[model samples]
Target chain A: MTDPTALSCPAPAAETERVLLGHGSGGRLMAELLRDVIATELGTDPIAEDAAVVDTGTAEVVTSTDSFVVTPRFFPGGDIGSLAVHGTINDLAMRGARPVALTLAYIVEEGLPLDELRAITASAARAAATAGVPIVTGDTKVVQRGAADGVYVTTTGIGVRHPDATPSAAHGRPGDLVLLSGPIALHGTAILSARESLGFESEIASDSRPLHALVAAMLDAGGPDVHTLRDPTRGGLASALNELAETSSIGVDITEDAVPVPPLAAAACELLGLDPLHVANEGCLVAFVAPTAAEAVLHAMHTRPEGAGARVIGSLTDEHPGRVHMRTMLGGVRVVDMLVGEQLPRIC
Target chain B: MTDPTALSCPAPAAETERVLLGHGSGGRLMAELLRDVIATELGTDPIAEDAAVVDTGTAEVVTSTDSFVVTPRFFPGGDIGSLAVHGTINDLAMRGARPVALTLAYIVEEGLPLDELRAITASAARAAATAGVPIVTGDTKVVQRGAADGVYVTTTGIGVRHPDATPSAAHGRPGDLVLLSGPIALHGTAILSARESLGFESEIASDSRPLHALVAAMLDAGGPDVHTLRDPTRGGLASALNELAETSSIGVDITEDAVPVPPLAAAACELLGLDPLHVANEGCLVAFVAPTAAEAVLHAMHTRPEGAGARVIGSLTDEHPGRVHMRTMLGGVRVVDMLVGEQLPRIC
Candidate 1:
């Protein structure tokens, strides 16, 4: 007799008998994997937010974790070490939390140079110090050569939620204005350039940085009016906006001309047959704010170096719920769907 | 002209130019790598304890993170899923805390079976439910084939410390009684048997179980007198004892005859020419208790199923600080040193 309590997992489709690289691309396939497999068993919705907020009886705590597997380890602007710190920090910031401490665990492959490991750790430490968050504890494990890549870092962060902040993707309302924190695609373009040896001029560097301070400023300015905050990471801006739309049951109308895309990144994306909106951004955020507080939040964001290029690129609407539409520069409308599969694998 | 703030990293020695498989064995080589590379660059000691306790203003919070890369995924008793959950819970329990929440992250390799992934998630969820802790948040990433073995799960846990409990490795003092919660070597031998296809007659299952409930019982029986608690993992009892000695500046003298080693595990270890003392255990813990309260704690521990085989294995002394000696069954005293290199890789 089959146990009723045992989960009856469906077999993978013929096309997906085994996991493909696309399943980790933070795109449509990844979403399907989470919805069909992980979420059904774990009993929690995984796509709702970047961090989980838990009440610890005495105080509300927010926790976020990410694994860094970016190839090349070292890039034009930041190494894997710093990227690991900034990634989790940014996740906490998106939830309007003050990150307190972090735990780092490393899986190093056999035969990795000690000098390289030192450089990575030092860079990580410096990033933590700059963000004022100490790495309190850590674990190290080594795998045999050929069993693992050079190194993989997994970092988890603990933070205290801002008192007046209740930002969430589900909180976006029809009248909210969507804001872009800065230019997109720089981080992804830089990594791809380095990996492919594209020799692109202008030396586009990754915008890898911690965004907690900028988040603090916006929270201070908008208070409870900030409806949603998200970083356009793996699947990038299009994925983030579509997620917000689905979660809030609202429609997003973004103007292509209003989106901030650096000329270098835009050109690189065009040449590489990539969509800038679908390319990842390491140190940028997209915010949905009440129209009344949108101007003030944008002004506050502009005061910070990380958010100097902040702009209002879209607005939520009730016409087409759970969808995102882009107003092209040529005055035509187009649906902006989530990327279907892996575009750039191991790009943080 | 050296940059003042740049970390002064030493070059790798000729014989150790690259990381070896031994570096992740939780043995001597791992310690050297930590001391010479990781600790110096991160600017924090990584070997002091299992979990790092932090003051959260309202209450004390204990946090621990571990990356699980156990090969074969499934074993006789438990899978990597339950092991990941139990491992972090044990770390929290070692510090006398009540584990409240957990975060799970996965790094999967391409081509992994979806059925395997589903089984792992279901097992992990069941483990978390059994332990009364919720996996509150999670992240999943995929690496290309050969970049990762199959799947690596990293779990981070948060728990609230008991008000009356102040257990620490540094708190062990002379005359404290050393207690072993249960039999040793079962977990390591089970993994080895599965990995090497060794046809041992008895199925020595891995003793992977959550130890929080047992720990709570010990605390209740001997609050404020449970000097220290440590799970015998990775480098097993010998490494754990050496670490406690170094941290407490005390010596431990254990009686080999008094220690609990299941006959099946002993036979298997003997067959493989491995020391049961240095073999890893997942469910067992070693505790240092004040002499006056030792009997009460042991009695309390025995009442629990997980600790049914509890025994007084040793006592602390001031004779040789930072050393461990075992009174052999033949009435001869022998020194027990930490394992020098890889004994069993990815055991937990």
Candidate 2:
């Protein structure tokens, strides 16, 4: 296991002084901040999972939180409101939990159009209704015009753990196979195109959909053999896989041809000189399944709309434990490392 | 019952166009935003309770969320960190829940000092530890320097419901007695003084504390007799009483002299031309208890440090349903109304 204290020691003097955008990029810097500062001070053990499971003496409850500050607030497939709901729901799903309730908190800037706020609220409500989870309570705070962006949404989700499932990033075994639920980088590409007006907007739409149903299907088929489940969100597929490998103390091997990427998003990534593997995704999830249930899990995933793009991208290995190696399409081996700094900020 | 849709009516054109600081002042505007917009769109019934109870088949879980963006980051009694933790915990406690876990999320401005963030994190950790609740998971997102203040902490707390307690503002009856947990307005006074450099720094400290223990004692003593429990945070005692009166369709009658306000905070409010009853408070709570159980609840409250100033401040009456009135020391009665607009912004 990585020592949480070690992440603090090597932080450069400059990096340790002022907060950087990279510190919230869901990359190495973000990880360092979480472990060295947040975890150490909060006195909680670091776990490589999207949500924490609390045994409430009766039933285990899963909880997670995320803040959405996506610039522009509105995007192609979904707005910040919908994104906020889906993001927290997906986090609970990543832990094999059935989301039960969500709480919405808004940090709205003064002078933000009330009509716009209404629209966002409606969209969030619709999203929650569609997911069948109720937004049970909410809080709103407005700051001075410049004190905050238009609106930043923070969503906290509560879910009940599935009795038959127990999934964790640290549960990955050496022989476990890695699976991708859907095409990668669509959300990242969409946000970048919209923000920079890169003209790829019409072609790429964010895959910002809820993945709890997809997770439920996979859990039904794989049960405890699902080993590990994670939504490749802010740090994307590369970081998700790296986190699992590090937590499980196993190496990962993937084939470049096997990792699914939408053609339009791929072209956009290539044109922008961005790595598709390093881009963020809102809907897709990465799973490590035991060899015995891999095929069944893949078949089950294919039956769900969100997981139609499911495929076995790689397998956990005993070699190079704690690292990921990719077999390039051109027959060359390369180490795939976690992102070091900001790439697609606020994509989710 | 207040018709939720009526709040959306007669909203002046200018008011409907953009959000004002009043919409977040925890007053009438904030109430309208919640009932007319958030609740209506989300298709949920509004309840005058700090937290929502979610039934998970086997257990009832209470959930609440709050965002703290108090300016200056640090204040006399506590910093934003402890406030974040205490605020959410008190929300759950007000709903008669025993906190189990909390999720902390931060939207930090890019240029904030890391040292400041560290201090805040440590303070939050200490606060959570003191409350005996673990901050199980967290998320951090950094926005551009202009996108946010130094840092905003959003805390979501999850707690198990107390079996014998079922408190709600709507449960108040005409015969119920209103109780004050402690001295009020210190938080609002402290924030205002610190923000304006009003030189009352040493004398006034924000009563930013966790009140779950005090709540537990009250619950143990009064159980089902505690009709309503609300933290007089934003909009202070006046707003809290007004909300309870409206929710219960009853009238609240208070004696001005009986309301507990710290001497220094009261003086500060007088000097600033702010009403102590309208100022915010952090640690204190307003409870509506059955008349027969009022003395027992107050005695139990006084047993806890946080509730040392517990006393009867008022009682519910049928004479002026949906209104609050205070009998002045000079033998004059005046109607007290909920705050209309922002008195103090970003106090919590």
Candidate 3:
């Protein structure tokens, strides 16, 4: 027989077996461990199952998956469970697919209380219902104490994309009109101020939202005139816009005054030595429209409560391809760069 | 303007911010972060045309997504990148979908060497090509140096599901023959032996594979007789069987003699105090077939290279719903339990 050491599981208290950054590496190591131990043992699929089953339809279906690893597990307006469903659905909606079914995969730490899990699950179900999506499948697994945080949920969603929809970074072209679905920075600021370090509170709360309805409306009003659609997520507006600029090999021009920045977000950015344009925003979208159709697109976005705050924030440019130059309040220009670092890591 | 304290990003470099178990909790805290930050900011709906354009689909497609968080990033048979793609494609095929497009989301640490990132990406691309899956959309961001491992990849895949085929856990029924597509435990044993503390030398390599072809064969052969299908992932065969038993609410009686075991896997398991039954198998599958169609199913599986080691490992029983029993080589009965803790982390 092999030495007992060779057969042992990592002890929760053992410093050597402690969690490392490599645990998150999307490498063979993570795959093997998850498959052989956690997933198989948990009675779930070891290989990821993002889009498993979908009904064929006239509206082409699009599916998206997201894993939430935000700290605290609770915040101002929403929690992880709700976020899991909404985030994935929004990903599909961006492709102009009406959100449909969802699968929730939860990795819960052993010591997590039943109440919390139940609450999260309940919230997830509720969120799905609220967004007109169904949580058709789910899985739960327990990690050894200290092996993980309370719980981590990976949500996979399937939706139907509109036939005329052509949404991707590469589709951006010079002279496209850039529009905002709503105000920026509320979500990031609310969560930040909630932190103990700041111990500050305001009317501000996360601007979490579901975008399927909003997307449906925009697509309906704009038809094929919409050149691109994206929800500014991790790296926020700057990072997301920068990616599009580079992909389409076009420059973008945005006016600081034109972009909607709620006062709360503005106040928070001033103190943090950060740029509001660079800060993160949820419940907001950046759309590139045919310059001629910009007015119609703006009108369509305003049709929804979530998009009421929407406005024309910028436009694509032929000069300075692959650059994003923001117009300051003083009418001067400043370049927007991808977040020097994620606006907040582990935020999602 | 807010004070500097209020301006600071919620996730500071404080030791507490490094990582807390609460971060994984699927509660309100986690949700708001994802909704407001990750999903809201970077993942804007690309269909809006102002942000970016993402393809919905033209052909039937299969898509899957998973995050890698295994403790070790390297194993004997593979590393994280290769495993990421294989695990992904395998999932797509399990749904009988032919994989085509993939989206890679990467979270990198600030201080990671450029070479490591390049290497992992290359490996991922190679694996995708090998499986005939191309990664057309990707997103990358860097976290603080210590916030994450060198990198973590979350791959979302899209493929076309097999026509006229239905595969779901709910499909399993009573009195069905069970077929294991390949020899098991190569993945588990390889990872176990590769542990730093339990160092042992064995030719054991992870059984990671893309099982689309294998899936196709069994479906074609079984025709209408195939009742259910599943890929034993994370916890190994025992966990998978246990989960299926619970889901199907049926008893599973397997003959140790009928289950194919590679000599190396068996020897390694014995030496390491691990049960080969609880080990993970990637390039493997467990199919349930009606008694009348069992022969055709077996014949179809063995015809394929991936199924050469296929065997009739067991059958479902109507009695003792939601339980599993094993007939040992000595004609003894034993219960197989889901894995309690990780046997080896990241054995995908």
Best by lDDT: 1
lDDT of 1: 0.80
Off by over 4 Å in 2: A1-58, B1-58
Candidate order, lDDT descending: 1, 2, 3
lDDT of model 3 at position A319: 95
Report the lDDT tens digits of candidate 3 across residue range A1-348. 789997888667633233222232222344444454444332445534324555545324455556676556777878877877777777777777787666666655554655566567667767787887766444443445554567777776666666666666677777889988988877666667776445445567777789889988888888778878888866578877887887688999999888878786787777766666666566788888888878887898888999998888888988999889998989789988766533465556
Candidate 1's DockQ? 0.11
Give the better candidate number (2 or 3) by lDDT.
2
Return the TM-score for candidate 3, rounded to 2 decimals.
Answer: 0.78
lDDT (Cα, tens digit) per residue for candidate 1, span B41-121:
323443221112233444457788888888779998899989999999998888888888887777877667655666787
Candidate 3, residue A267: Cα displacement in angstroms equals 1.5
Off by over 4 Å in 3: A1-52, A56-60, A63-65, A106-114, A138-152, A171-176, A196-199, A341-343, B1-66, B95-97, B100-103, B107-114, B136-159, B172-175, B196-199, B335-348
lDDT tens readout by residue for model 3, B39-138 = 3333333222221122445444455566664435667666677777777777676666666666555555555554555566667767777776665544
True contacts kept of 2: 0.28
Q: Mark the 10 consecutive residues where model 1 chain A has the least summed lDDT.
A: A46-55
